[model samples]
Target: MTADRQAVTQVLSGLAEIRPWYQDLYRHLHANPELSMAEYATAERIATELRNTPGADDAEITTGIGNTGVTAVLRNGDEPCVLIRADMDALPVREATGLGYASTATGTSPDGSSVPVMHACGHDSHVTCQLAAYRLLAAHRDTWSGTLIALFQPAEEAFDGAQTMADDNLADRIPKPDVALAQHVLPGAAGTVMISPGPIMAACDDMFITVHGKGGHGSAPHETVDPVVLTAAIVMRLQTIVSREVDPNDVAVITVGRMEAGTKNNIIPDTAEIELTVRTYDERVRTRTLDAIHRVVRAEALASGAPEPEIRFLSRLPLTTNDPAVTEQVRQAFTAHFGEDRTRPKEREAGSEDFGIIPDLFGTPYCYWCFGAHDPAGWYAAEAAGTAGSDFPDCHSPYFAPLLDALDTGVEAMVVAALAWLGTDRA
Candidate 1:
């Protein structure tokens, strides 16, 4: 490793002092989870935490930037500005982790329906580590000269807040960045880092489809056009899209996450609703997959003599491609702090992130990495004992939870990365 890279270790050490405070803050955010665009209390809590931290002295904090989003800027001089981003939104999943801090909070969805909320995606950890980095960035102003743009964006789970912030002229409000960086917690040995070049995550789209039909008594199948049977056929056909239509070399995942239909077993419902999420690495594959979905739904409905199916797109995010050079720089920085074995290449995930949009708005380099949140030994022990519940869970699972080690390791890696790239031009 280069001497410059070795020196970054000191940055991690200096920032390690704030890890305890943020660890406590992470539990608070996790317990009081909120949904996308409804992160009012979450944002307020973030603002309060920042006010009590080191950066609060010189930071410029703004709230409701994109309907509950917060942005804090701390500038030391004329050097290049680095924007570190974190998302603040919880999923509509009931708590199953059974942790003492597991959320019992519920949020109101866009449709005005009550839904259970949980930090299944670890945004809570991301926000807490972000606060730790902010405090250190302010305390170590002499170690680097530049502006630090700490973006606590909202609704990332919905894949629209980054764009919404842009629509609201986010770049106009704060000092634009020289480079952008962010991270998430994924399944791995605790304290390990994972990143890759090119496409780090898939482009994703959520679609809502409703098959309409005439309602009738279930006893007389001939008397009714069965939308439930039609929906089943449509769901099965949607699965074939990846195997038969998409190229073998390219990857695609189409998951029907939700299905709702009849209220009674004896009554044939007039309509059945389905919610699906599609993921692809290439734009061409994504377009083809979407087209295939529409064709399948419409054709299946037509075959059942159902009314025109209603198809509504819920949300979308372009593929997240990390700048190769910037990613490698952090990879080395991570290796420097945690050793070469602790930092490794992570296979690109089928899941998506809205962070990709930030680089386009600022026209700067960005790298989004994931650190493992679970204990390595415990994860292995569970696997060996054939105990699934005791295993490390994936993000978005109702039972997903990361260990306390995530708080310190995340902050250390983030602090070193920000310090390493703070005042330099993107190569």
Candidate 2:
């Protein structure tokens, strides 16, 4: 075996000895989840773990960056730096997994709803894997020469944490990272990692449309302008934009997730509203899709003889693009550490990630890969049942669970990638 592979094997073996502790940490975070912008306890727990870590030095805890965000710095060398990020916030989903460590923690949302919070999106697992990788890198600092910035960010689900940190000049304050790396726990193909070269994730924009009309008695036929009809027409026409306007091969998705109009059956409402999410893989498509949406809404409303619709863009997330050269480097590192069988080319994902903002601002190379979360039983059952829709609960679902046993593999993969980038050893 090559020297680099030998070193990776040694690190993996060492990681095995401490896997139990990492699992415990994952369980702890899973059981006590926190919501976005309210991750005070979560941040404190992660900071404590980093402080207790063997190679952790000069750990700094800063709060209120993106509203309840925390960033911890770990340095081993004074050379060029790279940043590894892990999101720390959890969803306000009620636990339904019935696991022993299921979350019973409760929090009040900004909307004043009492909800049970859990790590249903697997942010807990992300944080745990990040800690494990940090420990391994620290233990083997002698093998590489560079700086490591381990960021524990908050509010990824809301998709504003990365941008908030960047706006505060987080990168310039620390060693400016030449490249940024992050990973998401996916619910597919256990024991495998998936990555793509560019535009791996889609840009997401939330749109709200309010349609105003004349409120009158239901008995009136021609006297009232019915916004419900106008809203319905708009939703139906919105789909045509994707099917007819956009190229079928381009992968643009426009979904109207919510619609509300009237509260009383006997009376026509004065206003109707619809909320939609627009997703696209390219900037040109993103702009065209949005502009088309507005045009369709206005034209439909005018045709229906109703008032103009009020359109608002609630929020947006940029597309995640992986630099081709950096992605090839990562693939080479994975091949050197693991066998050729363990590494495979990946396809584009329709989902969005806040990490995309880094590449938008600094023009730094960024890549976010998927870590498999299926167990043996889960994998077989899914395959046998032909229900492998999603191997684990989706990121925002209430039942999202991660396989802790596979974490060591993820840590080792990250270590190999980091070492390869530092040009310390080659197999």
Candidate 3:
């Protein structure tokens, strides 16, 4: 390592040290989880933590930027500004993990429905680590140059907080960042960081398809067109889009998550609605997949002699692609700290992230990584038994629980990434 590299890593390692105090903060946030855009208490707590941290004076902060979002700004020297982000919303899943910190809290969802809340997605860890990273970077401002813009984004689960920040002029408020960085905790062995050069996460589209038909008694099959049968045909045909239409090499998924048609066995409803989530890494595949779905739904409805079906696209998330050179630099820096074994390369996942909004909107290059949130031995063992991730709790599950041991690696990785982007030259 060069003298400057050594000096920066040592100083940053010391600064990013996980303190005993963060445990309670993490647990408190986990226990009192809030839903997207409704993170009133969660937002307040994060803002309070940064405001009262030891080096609070160096950072100028704001709240309510994107409706319960908080951004803290810290400037060190003349180097290029670096943006670091963490999501701040919890999912509507009730806690089944049985941890002491598992959320019993229920909150209002975006649609104004009362739902149980839990940090099943591990946003709690993301927020806690960002708080730690920001405090340390601010405390040791003399170690590196450039500005630090840390955003505690709300509504990631609702799929729009990062975009909301952009709409509210997040990039214009602070000078646009030269490099953007964010990390997520996924179900894997602890202490490892998964990095991919381009298309780390899939592009996601949420849509709903409605099948129209005449309502009639179940006993009188000839009198009415059965919407339930039409719904079944549509669902089955959707399965062919990936296996038959899209190239085998291209990654894509079409999931029919929700289906509703009849309230009673004897009654054939007038309409059946199906909610779908589509994932793809390539735009062409995404387009072809969505188009195929529309065609299948429409053709099936028409063949059934039913009225025209309705299709509505709910949300679209851009694909997340890491900047090649920047990713390699961060990978090398992580390998130095985690060794070659822990800092391994990863492939593009079918999962999606609205977090990609940061780089897309700011026009800044970004690198996203997944840090494992489960014990290695158990995770591997679980995978062996035909279970999820070697038994690691999957995100968004009522039973999801992130291993706390990964927190330190996440904090340090963010610190190392920021230091690298901010450069090693000291003032």
Top-TM-score structure, candidate number: 2
- Model 1, 301-388: lDDT tens digits are 8899988999998988889888889888888778777898778797887878899787779888898988888878886577478773
Best by lDDT: 1
Cα lDDT tens digits, model 3, 1-427, are 6533664566556543446667778899999998888889999998888888776576778899888889888877646888899999998898998898888999886577899999999999999888888777777666677788898899988888988887887766776888889999888778888887988889999998888899998999789999999999999999999999999898898999999999999988899999999999888898999889989999999899999999998889999889998898888878877889888777778877888787778788999988888887877677578685535567898887777778887888888777778856663
Error of model 3, residue 318, in angstroms: 1.9
Instruction: Sort the candidates on lDDT, descending order.
Output: 1, 3, 2
TM-score ranking from best candidate downward: 2, 3, 1
Error of 2 at 116 (Å): 1.6
Note the Cα lDDT for every prediction shown.
Answer: 0.85, 0.78, 0.84
Model 2 worst lDDT window (10 residues): 418-427
Q: 350-376 in candidate 2: lDDT tens per residue?
A: 878898676556667867787667675
The better candidate by lDDT, 1 or 3, is 1
Q: Estimate each model's TM-score.
A: 0.83, 0.90, 0.88
- The superposed Cα distance between candidate 1 and the true structure at residue 170, in angstroms, equals 1.3
Question: CA lDDT of 267 in candidate 3?
Answer: 89
Tell me, what's the RMSD of every candidate? 4.0, 2.7, 3.1
